[model samples]
Target: MSLEDLYREVILDHYRSPRNKGHLDSPDFRAEGVNPLCGDEITIDLAFDGDQVSQVAISGQGCSISQSSASMMSEAIKGKTKGEIEDLTKRFRDMMSLDGEADIGLDPDRPGAVLGDLESLQGVRKYPVRIKCASLGWNVLLEALDGEPLT
Candidate 1:
């Protein structure tokens, strides 16, 4: 099996059985995101301890890319500080961008360099239209973290 095949399998696994797919009893922050183009919608609920994210839950209806991305994001951001989440968000956006090389901004020397399975979605960058589909959950996550009103 090739690397692309592995990434596809990872995405399919996450889509079929998502992680952190639910809601919290009383979340500190919540935001919803929608992609009008593809009709993907997601809601993110987050609970924070001090400046770190204590817990996260997501409920959504969307394509495999959106749902799986949300699942991957929920797992990746758990126990991370707001700064780390923001940085990850930036890095993820960079990865999704079509301009220049796709550097996920993860340094191998760092603790979380692998980006877990989230890197599997890097292939989506080739499909410019699907980028928004994959980013739906992440955009909602950023909004929730920023205390921005849901759109």
Candidate 2:
């Protein structure tokens, strides 16, 4: 099968059986975001081990792109320091072309090779309308990173 087809399959797999799809009873940080344009919403709950993310739980409702993005983000950020997660977030945003560029520092030909399964979402950029759907989870993650801890 083609690379594009492979990526599409990866996305579908994540959507159908998402990882970290739940809630944390006590999260160090938590944030929720909504894409009013498309009604995609995501809530990120983080449990940190000092400066690193020890655990992550995500509960939300949205399209495949948004939900799968959350699943991928949860996998990528676990056991990562806030700084590392921030860098990964920037790299992911770059891949999404949200910052006017898409330089993920790896060969786009071999997507799953790096960034876990996130690069699979790159194709969403082709449809500008779906970009937000693809990034709704990342946006919520950023808010959780920068916002105050959950009370």
Residues 44-142 of candidate 1: C-alpha lDDT, one tens digit per residue: 999888888888999989888899999999999999998999888878888887435477565645634567788878778777778888888888998
RMSD of each: 3.7, 2.3
Per-candidate TM vs. native?
0.85, 0.91
Local accuracy of candidate 2 as per-residue lDDT tens digits, 21-89: 888999989999988887887888999888889989999898888999899889999899988998988
Evaluate model 2: give its TM-score: 0.91
Per-candidate Cα lDDT values, in order, are: 0.83, 0.85
Give model 2 RMSD, 1 decimal.
Answer: 2.3
